[model samples]
Target: MEQIQEAYDALAIEFAASNPKSKAAYDIATKCLPGGNTRTVLFYEPFPLYTERAEGCHLWDVDGHKYVDLLGEYTAGLYGHSNPVILKAIQEALKRGLSFGSHHADEARLAQLIRDRFSGIELVRFTNSGTEATLMALAAAKIFTDRSKIMVFEGGYHGGGFLFKSGPHPVNVPHQFLMAQYNDTASVDELIAANGEDIAAIIVEPMIGSGGCIPGTPGFLAHLREKATEIGAVLIFDEVMTSRLYSGGGVQSELGITPDLTTLGKYIGGGMSFGAFGGKADIMSTYDPRATSTARKGASVPHAGTFNNNVLTMAAGSAGLENVFSPDVARTLHGRGDDLRNKLNSIAKGTILKVTGCGSIMNIRFIATPPEDIHNVRDLEGQSTLLLDMLHLYMLGQGFYMARRGFIALSLELTATELDGFLEAAQGFLRKYATLVSG
Candidate 1:
């Protein structure tokens, strides 16, 4: 049998040849954006395909090749591209005008809709991205509690600047972050015991999204809630990605554990660039502008973002939350994705490939043996990425588009038939690569 590397290189050659237009686009983009990509995750070996258009659950690359969009814009395209409701809302807002430098009712409308959907967000504020939302959430915690230490789990991803793989990224804010092992209650417990008095917040994702879509163990998450509360530290749940797991709330709602502050983004904006952070009024009140006296005394965390309450984002978000991704739609889509993941896992039962995730998001890992569990980045890192990347190229050839990192996020626009097609492609790939991937 050929070495996996050789087979993958041959596949890459075919991919590149078939994507001449994307190649040209990349050549042009490289002069502007580094490596022809602004988002590092989209960068893959050889080159990445450039998409020309997307509608519903499909995307057409610049080379005119079309594929099912299983990446779902990294879980932010929950409404799918060109969703009629979202389009209509944005169009209506555009007719009125774009960003209003001043406050508007649209902000109140969107905020109310969010509050109605999420019980934990008593008072909310908007930002341009999830990165900003989490940045502010931690800020609120620090000011509200007057502490600086933060407890974060390894492999946990809050935002671009807030990533903690093994330790803080080079560009990560200079916060005093205490690293704990994801899904290991003891790691968190030990940190809380030592830093309880100095810790201001315990921030975590309900599931590690960028770190490979690993879900948090219920016990570990519960321990965080209890310890953070006992320590008088703010517990912030970064639900920017997992909020799509359900409409009423996210993994927290499923697990019945509430955090003091919840940061949000992605689908909440109805496919627009948007984010939010809010929770118990007291913690959020740290940014209360009405407290002019507090601001004068330097006690209030005065917040300002020119487009924080952008009129267009508010209209689209309000419509998506209230009209498109209602509780019923969320439940139905999540059920469909769950069914798809189960089928894929069953087909991969005797092979190196394994799938893990919750609801509509999941990841694939190839290993020599089935892992006991994969609750942290280190566990995922131990797996073989060779077969995983092969799976990516093979599936792309089969008209399915998933993340290069083995991540899959389904869109509500996908019908059951399209989902079934995805399953067939996976089974076929397993059969074709039996010699390489089989145990």
Candidate 2:
């Protein structure tokens, strides 16, 4: 442990000195923000890299060092930074107006584009972030079903909301949120059997995000859909991170499964703050003003936000999705991801490391081979977080940028050459850090 700490300390000093602007900015941010950063997601071992700019799958740090941006803003930069189409859309919208707090054609146009692709969505509503989208979806489920309980996968992270926080809650209302093992049909069945008719919804990430980028087995997801239908519970897919995997939505296009509600974010905003939730027409109609008895001219679900459906976000999101949904782009990304996965697996063959997750969204588990069959969150206990932290910092020093949690998301702009470069860097890092990693 001491040796590992020393290695990290050395790297921290090197990182700080390597970029004077980032170091200074980090120091200043610490005074106003708790951890020298606004979002905890951006925090890294030595300190986060403060970027001067980014363009087409590359990031330049404040000190002007360039790197392949594998992190991709937690999988949100599917089109890469400053994409021409998205940037132009944003600029065009700026001339019109930023917000109106009223109806906008762009909002409905974007909504139609999403509805056309996602199997589960007949209607949709916008929110500022994935957190809000998931929250609203959960609330809608509870209200529509008149049930208090929600079932969530153990390793699934829907956001940092109180209801989804780690551990059991004592309050009656939020306490109804129960956890089951991810990708484990039996465990999920057991939970549903125990709670039965009381469960309003079963929420899961089609591919786990932050809990290690693990994908759900087909059988497990299928079972969840069946169970939800059997017990009259709404099945919700939180695809904020995995939506990039498919042109039409992740689970629906990839696995041929449909959910009652789907929450989306990440790339949809085109690097801006955005989120959305949508589902079957009947369920979504619960938010319709036409069905309400309120005296107001237009009212729905008691939902209103200052920035919801802002024109800039709508325009940029439409542009981003247009590029993302192209068949050629998807094929290119998946091909690169497959190459990266195969190469990493080969390099780690003799070592105690393993890689997992679906196309484009992957993770490197350290000190153990992730189960030959990883069906649930509990299966992840076999890996070592300490080793993961060491590996993350080591790779960072070698010019790779990924989450300490081992999440990696590829962008549309990264070419085959860049993919090979990243693999070469990983191979070199693993060879040098093998001794420390073995400990």
Candidate 3:
């Protein structure tokens, strides 16, 4: 039976009725926060499930409905909730203090760890969030190159203030962004030819996390590196979401193509708000606070943040990198993610439903037929949000939590059984909606 809108509403209505406490809380929240929501992604029709608590890959809602947490806090909960190591680190940091409001020794330790892991990152600076990291990276690029234009690909999302989906986000810092097609060397070449002289930097997420978990082609990424170096434009890889792909290293390591600068965040902070940016020493040294001779010569980039090295985040992040997401652990998580992505694609092979991603992150996409190459943003257009929402709600009813856009990520804590369960749930969704999703 093809489930109609009424059927979908019935499920949502049932979900709302069963969670009266959450609905009531939402009703109260509306008086304070807009639409009773703070994060736009968490809101859905009817209402979002109010999670009371979570441990490992499971969550309990306010109504006490237990769900397998496949969402993984949209990739921030890389260790899953309540990991003993991260929890202990947080608690211990709290006991010591929250913020010193000055430079701390632990910050250097965390920096050393990051430097040792990321081959492309020789120097780094912490930020309160990924948004800041990308923002500062761009600032440094423009200052170094003395250019006013930036080259960004469509569907590439660097941060909250650096969004370039349909168009530049209203809240985004205004920049002359030359939009290029992702994973398309020809389109990138066209943009470079048009704006190369004035382009200071090219910012890209190796995998478009928010737009879709779309991975970049190695050829395309390498081409960007070559062209950017030729034009003196800094190439910045925003690996905020993909940083956990291989512990501290990400696509740069996998593809064997390095960017001049890299921005990182998400799971790197052990589920805390964290972000970092770094690259070659010459570029990063521009932000040196030390009294350099260049200071008297009037060439310095002053970057400052009050909570850049909050003790809690520094301690938790260090512990997460050293203990939780070790190379061995990261490899296991990536393998499981590859397994789930393959299973989902195998199940939806002949249908409009297709899964696309790499490593431990992916997204479900609905189109008439899988494109011969999803190498550009234009290739991924015309996606049906209605189908995605229906599946999202259906999965939620089946005790799975996920993004409305069908994004799913795996944490180190997930087991083979849980991975199998997620695959089973996807298969079930396809079976129940087979008549509808079938071409």
Candidate 4:
């Protein structure tokens, strides 16, 4: 451990020396923005890189250091920086108009694409981001079920306001939330037995993102579907990051478990800000002002967002789905991720490093004797956080960019050569730090 700290200190000094321009940028930005950052995840100790430009899957920092970008903008950059197809679509939409302040043809087309893709989505509504989509999905669930309590798992992150890494975040919306253990059916069963009557919904990610990229077991997720139905609670699958895993239908479709509600964001809008929540016709009808059925009750749910149907997002999303990111492309990217992850695991076999994830998104952890399969964040209790930092700095020094938290989300634009280069660099890192990482 002492040796690991020493190596990390040396790497940090090297990183600081190499990124003086980013340091200067941080120094200047701190005066205006708190912590010199807007996104919480982008901030890291010793500051973060300020990229001057990006193209395809590569980024050039302010100091002219080039990097193969595996961060993929936290899964929102699946189309990669400057995808020509998405750019052309956005450009065409701009030529037409920006703020129509009303409905357009592209809106319905995008909604139809989403509905046809996700089997669970009978009807859909758009939002500006995944955060809004999750929030609105919860609201719809509560309204439909007429219940007060929401069941969520530890380590589940729906969005910024719905974080549950360890416990309810202070900024989280004040919903009556019931906590449960992830990938543990019995934990959910216990929660249902006690609070079944008051539970409105059970929201979960088929594979939890931003909480260590832990994939929920098939049995566990299936059990969530069964219990939610047995207790008359709505089941919501948050597929913000996982939607890209299995073409259109997501992991839920792959697992043959359909949720009552599904929330989507990231990549779906062709690298633009976008989100959507959809589900059974009955539940989604709550927002239909013109609905004559009892599904709407008496009043329609007021969901108002100016950019919900923004022309640019609708156009870009439609273009990407219809022309660029086809189902075959999705499958190829997923397979590539599986191959990359397997190679990474092979490289770390004799070390305290382990990788966990599904499809194109993954996380790296430095835990002595990591479980053959990580079920939840608790399973990673003694993971070396410092070692993860050391690995991040080392990778940066080698002209590879990944999330400081060890997250990696591959983009569609990355080539075999770029991935191979990253792997070679990773092998070099292992060789250089063999002493520090040895089990």
Highest TM-score model number: 4
Candidate 4 residues 1-439, lDDT tens each? 7888889899999999998999999999999999888999989988888999999989999999999999998888999998899999999999999889998999999999998788788999999999999999999999998899999999999998999977899999999999899999889989898999999999999988999999988999999999999999999999999998977569877888999999999989998889999999999988987757539558788899999999999999999898888888998999999889988998888998889888899998888756456898788888989989998999999899999889999999898998999889888988998888888
Clashes of 1: 0
Task: Give the per-residue lDDT digits (tens) of candidate 2, residues 1-439.
Answer: 6776776677667777787888788899999999887777778766677888888888778887887788888888888887889889999999998777788888988898788768888899999998889888988888778788989876667765633335643432453777887777777878877998899999888878777777887888888899999999999999888777754367666788999999999888888889999997777876777756432234557777889888898988887777555656766677678678878888777676778877788888874544356655566665767667766766666667778877788887878788787788877767876776552
Clashes of 3: 0
Location of the lowest summed lDDT over 10 successive residues in candidate 4:
289-298
Question: Is 2 or 3 the stronger prediction by TM-score?
Answer: 3
lDDT for each residue of candidate 1 in 221-300, tens digit (9 for 90 to 100): 89889988899999998999899896547877777898999999998888888999999887887888767533234557
TM-score of each: 0.96, 0.92, 0.96, 0.98
- The most accurate candidate by lDDT is 4
Put the candidates in lDDT order, highest first.
4, 1, 3, 2
Clashing pairs in 1: none
Cα RMSD of predicted structure 2: 2.9
Kindly report which residue stretches of model 4 are placed more than 4 angstroms away from their true locations once superposed.
Answer: 291-294
lDDT at residue 137 of model 3 (Cα atoms): 95
- Residue 154: error of model 4 in Å? 0.7
Weakest 10 consecutive residues of candidate 3 by summed lDDT = 290-299
Q: Point out where model 3 deviates above 4 Å.
A: 1-4, 293-296
* Candidates' C-alpha lDDT: 0.85, 0.78, 0.84, 0.91
